[model samples]
Target chain A: MSTPTHEMWTARLRGAWQRNLPIEKLLPDDQPAYVVSWIYVFGVATIAALGVIIASGVVLAFQGPAWYHTSDIGNFTNSMHFWSVQMFFAFMVIHLWGKFWMAAWRGNRVRTWITGAVAFVVSIATAFTGYLVQTNFDSQWISFEAKDGFNSMGVGAWFTVTNLGQMLLLHVAFLPLILGVLTLVHVLMVRRRGVVPPIDAVPGNMEVHK
Target chain B: MTGWLASFLDHPATYLKWGWFQISISNLIVILIMLALFAAAILIKFPKGRE
Candidate 1:
């Protein structure tokens, strides 16, 4: 007798998921000893900074622009958000540089590298939208200056940088959603693939006690 | 001295301009710090975990 359609589909999906990503690989107790490098810490640092950025941003969002502009607590939260973004970019750039030198795309990890690179590009757009929604003179100047650039690129019609409401929505909602999803996928890919071995080391055979 | 420091803090960021190239001192400092951190990350020895 043939299996029921729904049961077949569920079985296929479950089988694929378990076959591709076993629990042990997803959360391994021991990493390869070659993973003992300070450079590897930058990726975690970037994620930590992102956590702080999101926390402080949520606080700033609850308080209105005027509150952030005037109130001491609001100003402090805004500063936290700003500085966290700086840290995020700094650590991410360092992480990217380290990964590049390591040739981290080896061992069928090209998608992981691609997702990270695309996330960086999307982050720049997210940051640009952030600058546009700051509700300050700097934002004002930036919007006016950026509008011409967007227009020249022939995208100003849809991406109206000068429109504060639209820019705010993009900054707080659309761009962040994409960035968050990309980050999740990139990290999951890393866990599934395991860390890349050193350039000269043979994979799975060069375990050193570090 | 206090007044001068306050004035300096309140004023616009000082920029270093060389022809078409220009950068604020604050931004330059951040860049330099990032470079230093990157170099340190590469050079510094990582701790060995339990054998």
Candidate 2:
């Protein structure tokens, strides 16, 4: 007499899920009272900005750079993508710095910090590839200027930004795919860790006596 | 005033060079904005013992 394989696997998954993210922690409507500070809001704002950025970028991806640079509707979507990236970077930088100052890695939350840092670094690469694929004077100049430095480091052959086709594929596909994965990991870690409390916050102190 | 600040922040021609580092006005603006945001977040406090 043996347990069914399906049941065994299901039981293991259930155990892991329970150990990692119990339902109450995952969907708590009530937050700890110290969570009242406005700084906590920046993380949500950053996530929102990234959502818009990816949405606009996807729309832009359906059209080539020439179309976006020339046609009205394409131009509108391009502007949306441009501004969304700007907002994304702005919000992300603020959130990253805020978390750093808060020492957000406290109480075994180190994975959260590392994931966020990974997301930030990947975002820089994605943004640089984005600029290179812009099909404008700025892109040409940047590619030309950057090539020499890359050549000095002996990476120019692999990452030649001057090659529009290669750059477009990287900007539209590879880098964004990596960014999406990094963001997913970052979000899952945040969910698992819950939010970090302030430096002096007592573990079981539910409320502050005002 | 708005135009002046915009120009000050985005004067791409205004470049500064150091040992192996080069930056323009727009880059400076970004750095300043990030620092200001960081400082502002740090200055905001939660209630005592609330962490």
Candidate 3:
């Protein structure tokens, strides 16, 4: 007897998924002892700050620019969004510095490192779009100042910073979506590959004194 | 509060300029604080426990 088409496809997908990343590795309960450093905390801290940024941004979006400029509550939420972004960048850069020094791609974890680096680049673009959509004098000044740079690179044809509508849509939708997906992939790769062990902790290496 | 503290808090931002570089005092302070925090994170001892 032949298996049903749907069952066969489902079985193939399940086998591939399980072979690549089992459930335990995906949602690990423990980590290597080397991960017990304060430096490791910065990655989770960055994610936490991103959560605050998204929550505050959602509140700001509901109220709109005029409300945020006038209402005290709206102003408070805007501040939250702004400060959370500051925290996010601060933590992410610190985490990146720690990872670089640690040679975080030491094992077969090169994809994890690359995804993180790509996410950092994407975040800068996301933040730039955010600045363009602020609907304030600062935004106007920045857009005017940045226009020539974009034009010089030939990106201004499609990405006109002075166009508030386009900038706002990119900031509020496209860039955030891309950043979120990049972050998710980076984290999953970290989980699947496992955290890179310390350089000196490798067994049977006789290059230096203990 | 003290006079200097009040002045620093209430007055417009102070800026430092040298050649082509200029930065507001508030921004400089925040940058310094971030540096300090990074150093502290590296130096501080983290507690270890079994998972």
Candidate 4:
């Protein structure tokens, strides 16, 4: 006899956890030797850049645009935020390119690949909103320039860059929250699936339950 | 440290005086950053053969 829906769902969840996320898999000391490659570094570097971006962003959010643009500490924090965002995109693109060439979607890891792509798109939107909230010549100039693109796409009014409050809200709250959640899900999927096996190792070698 | 590094990325000039338009340091910074990222990506390499 089949169990009730709730009970069956609970059992399935437990089974999934045990099979995919045993303690060792979630926090592993031993990864496959194939992971000993410099290409892998970019993924971790991207995450590190994101940490800096979030930290500096929180500092900027605490102090308003006036303070951030004028005060020394605020300027420093804002620059940190800016440069970290540079690093974030740099590393993310490299990681994305490396994974793409490796065909990272293979080995039953399509969700992992899709989640990463979603996170990338969300992050780009977050960065675009950041540009709009800078409260400088850049913001005004970009707002006007960006207007043409959005107007062409029929989203000019919906995403008006000149709407400072709207831009700020999306930058400091909505976009970051969405990016953060997507990133977390991407990492969780990575942990669940483990890194995809090296292309050479996939042919005849036994697949380790890493 | 991030601030220190960003100092090197300081505005090279105030504005670019063009025939029809003036491009400010902010605009220039975006271009410079993209160039820097492209350069950095080229410099950081993965090994040619599989490990």
Candidate 5:
């Protein structure tokens, strides 16, 4: 059998794209009438926090990891970045917990829930890598401590914290890319399923479980 | 912007002077201001669980 030519591959890919689902089918512009509460903001809040984290991370990148460790300006930017990361994790955990208590996995949303949970797990790993990249006193302590933990768990056989080159690559590239992909998948699943409806339709006193 | 604002807080006429400190100070101030704005938005947007 002959290998597929570039033109054939491109044509097949375009056909797949044409067959792909539309965004509107995934998520409707008009939400259910019962979705009128501030609790929903947790998801958006997490996204916003991530926005800040990315922006701070970008600036810190431009300043370079070495500069961040040594220079005064870079130091402050690094601190801001650290705090942003903390906030990002905080918001994500809250959002995930909130969704769980709300039984957001109901109906056809099990896939969405699973995707979200996987994304959350990846995000935690990303944050852990970020801490390793810090290379501060905290980073040193965490490195040794976490290295031991992972070693005990047999994960250290593959991943090493002391390898600066590997850690840098994972921090600046791999972890982020993994998190980004998982987040994208989670979002697609959520949009496809649409937001889960609140339990009752009463406007004045309808209560949804935590 | 934040760094400049902070430096300007210390020396208001530093713009008349050239310093490598400008970028740092300016970015710091911008970060601070943006943080405050975001905090305010959060408060307003999520007020009493109206999310």
Candidate 6:
């Protein structure tokens, strides 16, 4: 009692999905068992560090540039934020390096790696903008100094580092928006692909190649 | 009011006052340098095929 139309439609749908995606490889629920190591924490750690940075950054933003110099709590909060940012960037660099060393970009993930690298560059630029928004003496110095470098590169007129308004908007709104989107894409790709197994994971391939 | 901002700004550069948890700029720079060297050491020691 199998209906030919239903079976034919199902076959066509399956073919379409297979044509659009390599369904044989990117199964939704399959992953290597070796992915259960403490080494996996580095990625989570980097994400947590970014969370701390954003929390601290919000407090700093609410207080504004004058508060860091005027209020005691503001100063302390600002210091915590500054330190958190430094730590966040440091951990992110490590996490990125670990992924690179493991060659996690292999298989169907080459585009993901390139997109992530672009995100890293953008994040660093966002951080530099945050520094300029501080408007403290250090911020002033870095701003003018960085402006000269940008001018020499011929993009200073377009970016205009002297404008605090523009810098603030970019830091709080634009860059964070870009970061959020990129992070979503990166996480989705990771979830879809799952963790890649180590090269020496085979039952008979465990012999050290080096 | 102006004097207070100036004084507060200068104080961070002088005697450390933010308790044990507080990190000084010099100490931060040293820790950063150590971290960089540590990462480099890992890269050198681990090499490519060994890890």
Using Cα atoms with residue i matched to residue i, what is each candidate's TM-score against the true structure?
Answer: 0.91, 0.82, 0.86, 0.76, 0.68, 0.68
Model 2 lDDT tens row, B1-51: 267877765654687889899898667988888777767766777554423
Better of 2 and 3 by TM-score: 3
Candidate 5 wrong stretches, greater than 4 Å: A1-20, A23-28, A201-210, B1-51
TM-score for the A-chain in each candidate structure: 0.94, 0.89, 0.91, 0.89, 0.80, 0.78
> Candidate 3: how close is chain B to the reference, as a TM-score?
0.72
DockQ head-to-head 1 vs 6, winner: 1
Q: Which numbered prediction scores highest in lDDT against the true structure?
A: 1
Question: Which one wins by TM-score: 4 or 5?
Answer: 4
Best by DockQ, which number? Answer: 1
Docking class of 2: acceptable
Over the stretch B6-39, how does candidate 5's per-residue lDDT look in tens digits?
7656753323235654445555665566556445
What DockQ does each prediction reach against the true complex? 0.61, 0.31, 0.38, 0.15, 0.06, 0.11
Q: TM-score of the second chain in each model?
A: 0.79, 0.54, 0.72, 0.48, 0.40, 0.45
Candidate 5 lDDT over A47-150, as tens digits, reads 77777877888888787868988888888888788887766766666666557667898877888888778878878887888888776787888888888887
DockQ of 6: 0.11
The Cα RMSD across the true interface for model 5 is 8.3
Against the reference, the lDDT scores of all candidates come to: 0.90, 0.81, 0.87, 0.83, 0.71, 0.72
lDDT of 6 by residue, A35-136 (tens): 444455556666787788788888877877788778888888887877777776666667676677779887788767876788788889899998888877
lDDT of 1 at A89: 98
Per-residue lDDT of model 3, residues A72-116, tens digit only: 888788889998999999999989988898899977888899989
- What does the interface RMSD come to for each candidate? 1.9, 5.2, 6.1, 6.9, 8.3, 8.2
Query: lDDT tens string, model 2, A96-165?
Result: 7778877999878898899889889988888888888888898999999988988999998998878989
Candidates sorted by DockQ, descending order? 1, 3, 2, 4, 6, 5
| Model 1 chain A: worst 10 consecutive residues (lDDT sum) | A201-210
lDDT of 4 by residue, A1-210 (tens): 877875788888988788878988788766665665677778889999999999889888888789998888988899899999988997898788778878999978999899899999989889998999899999999988988999999998888878889989998999888888888888888888888776778545543333
Judging by TM-score against the true structure, name the best candidate. Answer: 1
Clashing pairs in 3: none
